[model samples]
Target: MLSIKTFKPYYVKEEGNYIRVVLAFQYFSLLMDDKVYQFVPLESREIRINRETQAIENKDAVFVFQKGKKYNRITLRDLMCVKDFQDHLSKILSPYMILTQPKEKRDEIDYVIMELEKINLLRLIDLALDEKDQIKFNLYTEKLLEIQ
Candidate 1:
């Protein structure tokens, strides 16, 4: 689709990946990079990733929860795997780029990634397999990813 509404400068998205966005796609109308940008809206997706290895969880969600750098996870049971909310996570997560410092000669990119994740709530909340809101939570994660 059309990029953003306006042409903004460049921001380092991933470690070496930089994005020169026209409008910042965030959760709100926050002026990202000194220019206005709207987030892609909040949606969830069951991101498959291993917490310990920080890799995609390739096994099955049925196994016991292994403690690691896990994001909010829920077992997919039914159609409620993905849902939408007005409180799109982008609302809380879009400001992460502000924390990213220009790639320095002495700094490693990995450090910035870990630090930036602090701004995302999905990176925090955790629900047990049998938690009351497990289904709802999984669906939330799925929806968020779809939007992202």
Candidate 2:
């Protein structure tokens, strides 16, 4: 039997008004199961360590969740155990690289990515200013201006 031992999030970040949580899973398959499956966190790569800041900038490193009434009580485990959760995780985790994808599909992904970057930049600018860090605040402002 397949069973989940634990579900832990490695990293969580905010983009605009949404929360993106990156989860690492540990599972097991009992002796009766025909196929054994296991996830050993210590033996594998740290999901966030290999990723760079651009993972957030380009919006591909974590699963995005909107902040609102409906999803308020949901836990990381709840999300992970939901039906078709792997499909949802697959969609979020896939590296939708522009060069490798089909020509026709590239445009849509590129446009969405560019737009997400802009929004993320604006959010960073807001945070910098709020924290009174003139250097980063000014830097983000300049980047946004350049984008315009």
Candidate 3:
């Protein structure tokens, strides 16, 4: 069975009107068009990291979608319908200027990442409709708050 996991995109690369986001398992691209929404899969994409510039690239990757039932087109409306999609997108796309600086700047990036995760956890707490889940959320929040 195929498993799905939600993750903040590892990195993004822009080419023309297309933007490719490297996820944990694959490279997913989105065409920058207001009228349509779809994620194109770049197969056999080789990731290369430039040591000098600290840049990443997908070498020999074709800018095309895979063909089959599994590659069914996804619409913007469809993505919006998923719970917390907006929150996820907001967190993922936030400016990462802190990451571009030297290693000493990593702490700032780490803090941002932590804050986003905390916000997400709080949102999940709101979505926990059951008493059992609510209790778990309460405990988790208490523990998290203690640390903070």
Candidate 4:
């Protein structure tokens, strides 16, 4: 019988049009016939999911597994055929799929934050100048320069 003992992504990254879920041996492992097999990155450790559809794009992606010196390989397509495996994988990936923001949206948010910071610094600089505080004025100007 095949079962998941542990299944957690090592890290999740946003690529151009996809989300890459990277797995590591220490984080992901499964049980097969009562033996635990650690996942090996092999040629590729990343599983790509489409940003638009939130569907896994690399269903045919192969993963290598090892137990001591013995090695085995399986494609994601085959693994998903098992009901338990599919359900568990879906639960784990659901949050990532739902929470991913578009790159353009993220960039816009970042720009807004930078602008707000600049405005706040300018206000502080003005206050420092009004109070005739030389030290604060210099500090605020340095920060403004760095932001620019």
Candidate 5:
């Protein structure tokens, strides 16, 4: 029987309208006929999935497996027939498929947060000055300097 022993994406990348997932030998393995076979990428380790369709785009991508120096190559499509394999793969890839803000948007959010922190600190510093709290004033000033 064929079964998944380990399946974890080595890294995920967003490419245009697809998510490219790379799998390395160490991250993916299969158990077949009571023997474990580690997946080794022969030419390409990339598995591309359409963002809209969620279907694997590189079904012909080849992977190699070795057993005591004997190597075997198989296409990704061949593994799809294994029971629940697609379901398990979908589950593992789901986390990586969630939409994330682009770098520019993330940077904008960080800038806004920093500005708010600066504004809040300035108000606290003013309050400290009014109350004649030298220790609080010094602390807020130090924090403001660090932020800048």
Candidate 6:
């Protein structure tokens, strides 16, 4: 079964042509590839990071979506879509960058591998929604603040 237990929720920023709003929340699927299956509140795609480095022994992160199915271990840097088809897109961030001048344990760690075990810190990117997409976000954020 494709279980919700397999995914992690995260919020992210997204930029669009007409407007911009937070993605509210999204789901990252733990898979052989470091990929995200985003539930975008607006019309945009969300990006997930892979935690494994074995499948990518000599490659970088990637995402693949064709027909109505999503794929992992993709090798592309970017994907584009028009406004009409916006909403709930999948993606992966590859060629993971180790930005530190000095090496760290987190460097070169495969994001896909850790996701399967439930603890991970992959660099997932969220899409900010454009207004006219949802009317309940403000209320949601307020509720979040109450608990925090």
Q: Backbone collision count in every prediction?
A: 20, 0, 0, 0, 0, 15
**Cα deviation in Å at residue 11, candidate 6?**
1.9
Tens digits of per-residue lDDT for model 5 on 48-106?
A: 89876778899998878766787777788987877666866788678667566789999
Residue 59 alpha-carbon offset, candidate 3, angstroms: 36
User: Candidate 5: misplaced stretches above 4 Å?
Assistant: 96-148
- lDDT for each residue of candidate 1 in 46-145, tens digit (9 for 90 to 100): 2232223333232233211112332222232311132321123223224532343556832766666645654353543344234657766677577556
For each of the candidates, the C-alpha root-mean-square deviation to the true structure, in angstroms, is 27.2, 18.2, 18.9, 7.1, 7.4, 25.0
Local accuracy of candidate 2 as per-residue lDDT tens digits, 1-148: 3233333445555444334544543322111134333333333212331132223332232222222221112233443455454454445444432224567798998888889989999999889988999999989989988877
Predicted structure 3, TM vs. truth: 0.27
lDDT of each: 0.33, 0.47, 0.48, 0.86, 0.84, 0.31
Task: Tell me how far the alpha carbon of residue 52 in candidate 2 is from the true structure, in angstroms, after superposition.
Answer: 32
Q: Compared to the true structure, candidate 6 yields what TM-score? A: 0.16
Off by over 4 Å in 2: 1-102
lDDT, candidate 6, 38-108, per-residue tens:
33233233343323321222123243322226433333232222221222332222123223433445553
Quickly count the clashes in candidate 1: 20
- Ranked by lDDT, the better of candidates 2 and 5 is 5
- Compared with the true structure, what per-residue lDDT tens digits does model 4 show for residues 50-132? 86787788898998999999998988887777777777667766766656688999999999999999999999999999999
